[model samples]
Target chain A: MRFLSKALVITWKDALSEMRTKEVLSSVVVFALLVIVIFNFAFGASQEKMLLVAPGILWVTFTFAGMLSINRAFIPEKEQGCLEGLMVCPISREAIYIGKMLGSLLFMLIVEAIALPIFTFLFNLPVLSLQLVVVTVLATLGFVAVGTLFSALAVNTKAREMVLPILFLPIVVPLIISAVKASELALSRESWATLASWLGIMGAFDVIFLVVSFLVFAFVIEE
Target chain B: MGKSYLRNILSAVSFLLMAASLYMVFVYVPTEATMGIVQRIFYLMVPVAWLSLLSFLIVFIGSILYLRKKQSRWDVLARSSAEIGIIFTTLTLITGSLWARPVWGVWWTWEPRLTATLVLWFIYLAYFLARSLAAEEHRGATFAAVVGILGFVDVPIIGLATTLWRGIHPGALIFQGGLAPSMLLTLMVSLAAFTALYSLLLLQRISMKNDEIEIKRLLGLTAERHNTGDR
Candidate 1:
């Protein structure tokens, strides 16, 4: 219980800071909207074609926008030297990792929530279904699981902005694949059995990477 | 003297094994019934692909040991393995493409195995990039090691996800009817030859890394002495 609260304190710190500036959230929201708009021009030729491609478009926007958000997760701490302050506090490194990961996850979920309605209205897809919501949440969890660790690693390197996507996107390819497939099935209102397997893959990905990233994040942030 | 002699013997053994495997693959193993002559590349390609995975495993193990021990030798091992692994992975993709063009009618397909290997390639490329872009040597090794562990752990998940995404039966083409005895023998020889070659290159690369680290140390020592002399 104490550990959970300590981790939540870090998450609350990030949220408090984010609420004050709204820098990461506001930029990602705008960037995601732009991606959807551009993708519409590029792929929106016909109504039928739009439906076929909608799930892929949605995930691609979220993936890249989520990259942008996660990339900023550690930069503020690194810039202001708050990381040192956090490190000296009475908490394990794993706690800090989970706290940061949840912050990014929450931020991404908010961006997705805001984008989904506009996307449905623009693309004419009923992507607001419960199944799609579950798919989005599960897939995004798997993504943020790995993304947070890589973000920490990237911020420590030179050319951090360039480093994050290269390190992040490849690792998250499986998540994107499973997510897109699951979303497609959900949008089509397919049988639960077919959709269940992709969800299983995403779930396995989330569990494995969450544990692995949690274990190794200390190495990345260790001075 | 002793180290060089052992390396020379290893090189010689690798050379002989490679020559014998080449002869077996080209002349001894009968032309496969279905794919015929093009199937010859499979002997070399499969072994190279196997070594590529083996090299990454070495990187993963070396990274873990480096973190635990904080030893430069383990870092050297991880770095050397990653450099060799990337080359072998590139060869795997190219040779796979060559075989696929002749057999699968396209130069590329989103086959599950092929896609997984491609993702593996990207992950290691990012590994190298991270290593190079790090501001300090120890930091680079530490960061790269983290990537090494994460990359290896993700490989199986990537494979599974790709397979599920496409709903394709894995390796349906390669092992359809299984291999003939002679072909299997040839494969065994080739795999042995490649493994020996991998060890030979790894030994050479590790020695080279050691020399490089030594030179850097000596240079730092001389610079420190020069500063003290000025004082």
Candidate 2:
């Protein structure tokens, strides 16, 4: 109970801080929206063609925006030197890892929540479905799970911004592939059975990485 | 024999095996019934592919050992193996590309094995990049070990995911099947030669890393002595 509460508190702390400044949220949203617009212009994709390409565009934007947010995930703590203070606290390191992951996931979800409607409105695609939403949530959870871990790893590196993306993207290729596939099936209104395989992959990836990241976080964050 | 002598002998043996395989691939092995001499590139590509995967597996082991023991020697081993893995992986991709150009009729294709190798290449390149870019010197090994472990775990996932994605709409068509006895023999010899070569490169690189560390240690000691003497 103590561990759980402490993690929740840490998560709450992150959320409250973000709510106050809204720095990560605003930039992520703007960047995501810009990606959607650019993909629109770059591909010259029409509505009919958009459905075919929407899943790829959607994931690319989400991933890029997610990477952006993660690149800064530890910045405030790092800059203010509160990271050491937090490490010295009574809480277990695992709680800090979970808390940061939750905070990051929450921020990303907020960005996606805003971006999805706008993406739909512009592309005129039927992206606002229950299945699509489910797939999006599952995929984003897996992404943020790994992304948070890498962010911690990257922040302690010489060239943090460069370190994160190259290290991050290759590792999460599986997740992206699964997300794109599931999103494609959901958008096409395919049978639930077809989407189930992809969802299963996402679920398995989430479970494995959430546990792996948590276990490894204690090691990676040690000063 | 001394370690140096053994290493030199191993190096010599590797070269011999490689030269012998080259001759076997070119002359001893019969041309395939379908594709002619271009098929001989298979000998080069397959062995390199095998050795590269093995090299990465060595890195994974070395990394886990480093994390467990915190031994700088393990770190050296892991980094050197990664260096060798990248070299072999590059060879694998280039050879695969050459074979694909002639056989598959395209300069590039997203075949499962080919794409998976490309992803593995990126993962290890990232591994090297992460090693160099780690914020602190000692922390570099630990961070890289974590990535090394994760990157190896990712190999199967990538293989699975790429297969899944390609299942919906197929691309990058190519054929792989049974081989003749002579061809298999040539492949065996070539793989043995590449394995020997990997061993040679790994030993050389590891010793180089050790030497570099030794030099750094001596420099640090001399600087400390200068400071103490000045006081």
Candidate 3:
């Protein structure tokens, strides 16, 4: 309980700071919206054809925006040397990992929450469904679960920006594939039975990576 | 002395077995009826694929030991294994592609195993990039060890996801039926030969890395002594 609360405090601190600066959220939202517009022009498919590509475009937007948001998870601390301060705090390394992960997860979810409605409105697709939301959260959870760890790892490297996606994207290929499949089924209003396996994959990915990231993050963030 | 002897024996064994396997593949084993001449690449490809996977497992184990013991030797082992692993993985992908061109009618397909191998290739590249770009030596090793661990863990998940995604296609069985005894024997020989080659390369790389570290240490010592002399 105490650990959860402390982690929440870190998340709350991140939220408060973002709310103050309004940097990541605004940029991520605009970036996501622009991707939707550009992909629309790039594909230039008809309405029926649009449905076929929309799920991919949607996930790509989320992924890119999520990367943008998660990339900031550690860079600011690194630049400002707040990482040492965080490490010196009265918390386990695992708590710090959870805290950063939740912060990124929360930031990404908020971006998606804003982006998804705008996406549906622009494409004139009825993609606003509970199932889609569930898939989005599950997929996003897995994304940031691994992303936060890599974000920390990348922040320490010489090519900080270049390293994250290289290290991150391949690892999350399963999540992205599962998310795209699940979203396709969700958009098409498929039954739960059809969607279960993808959800399972996303769930398995989330669980496996979440535990692994939590364990390995200590090695990454150690000074 | 003992290590050099082991290396010499390994190289010799690898040379002899490779020669024998090459002969068996070219002359002894009957041409696979379906793949014909191109099937010969299979002898080289399968062993490399197996070695590639083995290399990462070695990396994974070495990384865990490095973290646990904090010994530079473990890190050296992991680094050498990863370097060798990347080469083997590249060979696997290239050979797989060459085999696929004639058999599958295209140089590439989104087939599950192919997709998995490609992703593994990407992961190996990422591991090397992470290592090479870290500014400090020990830090680079630690960062790479983390990558090594994460990359290995993610392989199965990537494989499963690609398999499920490609569930639309009937998975191609590598061989339609069990291998003939003669072909199996050839495969065993090739696998052994490749394993020997992989170990030989790993041993050579580890020694080279140890030498590099020793040189660096000596350089740092000389610089420190020069500074003291100036003071």
Please state the Cα-based DockQ of model 1 relative to the true two-chain complex.
0.84
lDDT of 2 by residue, A1-223 (tens): 8888999888999889888998778988999999989988887766778888889999999999988877667867887898899999999989998888888888888899999999889988788998889988998898888888888888888777777889889888888998999988888888899998788878888898888788778878998
lDDT per residue as tens, model 1, B1-231: 887998898899999999999999888989987888998999978998898899999999999999889998999999899999999999999998998999999999888778888999998898898888888989999988988998998887888888877787645634657788998889999999999999999999999999999999999999999989875
lDDT of 1 by residue, A1-223 (tens): 8888999999999999999999878889999999999998998579999879999999999988988888878987888988789889999999999999999899999999999999988888888998899899999998899999998988889988788999878988988998899989888888778888788888988999999999989888888
Give lDDT tens digits, candidate 3, residues B84-160.
Answer: 99899999989989989999899988887778889999988888888888878777888888888988998878877
Error of 2 at A70 (Å): 1.5
Q: Supply candidate 1's per-residue lDDT for A19.
A: 97
Note the DockQ of each predicted structure.
0.84, 0.77, 0.81
lDDT on C-alpha atoms for all candidate structures: 0.89, 0.86, 0.90
Better of 1 and 3 by DockQ: 1
Chain B TM (all candidates): 0.94, 0.92, 0.92
Clashing pairs in 2: none
Cα-based lDDT at residue B182, candidate 1: 94
Instruction: Report the lDDT tens digits of candidate 3 across residue range A1-223.
Output: 9999998888899999999999779988999999999999999969998899999999999989988988999899989999899999998888888988999998998899999999889888878999999999999999999999999999999888777899889999999999999898998999999999899989999998899889888988888
Model 3 lDDT on a 0 to 1 scale = 0.90
lDDT of 3 at B153: 92
Query: What order do candidates take by lDDT, descending?
Result: 3, 1, 2
True-structure RMSD for candidate 2: 2.6
